[model samples]
Target: MTTDELKGLKVASLVDARGTACPGPLLAAKKAMGDIESGEILEVYSSDEGTKVDIPKWCQKMGHDYLGVVEESSYVRMFLKKS
Candidate 1:
């Protein structure tokens, strides 16, 4: 989806991994998925450059819906749907 479309999403959970590196964001996203209901949207805020690729791959492997991302000044915001 477009950045504007993602911005308007109703996120069910948010994982902020801006302070951590590569796997941190992905791990947080994994954990956060347990907290939200199936089909709910999980938003991840990561400063790690690798998370952009890692998350989408993770989502694909995990059978979740990878909603795409939005890159801001310092962080990239990603969205995924729990499966």
Candidate 2:
């Protein structure tokens, strides 16, 4: 989804994993997912470049909906809807 579209979404939880690396951000997302209900949105912020690819792949493998990513100067925000 577009950044504007994602911005309009009601995120259920926000995981600010910025400053973390690789699996750190991914792990944070996994833990945060459990706090939200099914069909709810999770927004993950990460500075780790790996998260750009890792999160979407994780969502795909876990059967969650990988909405998209919004790039920022210091970090990128990824959106996912839990299945």
RMSD over all Cα atoms, model 1: 0.6
| Candidates' C-alpha lDDT | 0.94, 0.93
RMSD of each: 0.6, 0.6
For model 1, state the Cα shift of residue 21 in Å.
0.7
Clashing pairs in 1: none
| Reference-based TM-score of each model | 0.97, 0.97
Candidate 2 residue lDDT tens string, 1-83: 77899888999999999988878999999999999999999999999998898888889999999999999999999999999
Q: Which stretches in model 2 have alpha-carbon errors above 4 Å?
A: none
Kindly list the per-residue Cα lDDT of model 1 for residues 10-82, writing each as its tens digit: 9999888898986899899999999999989999999999999899899999999999999999999999999
Residue 15 displacement (Å), model 1: 1.1
Clashing pairs in 2: none
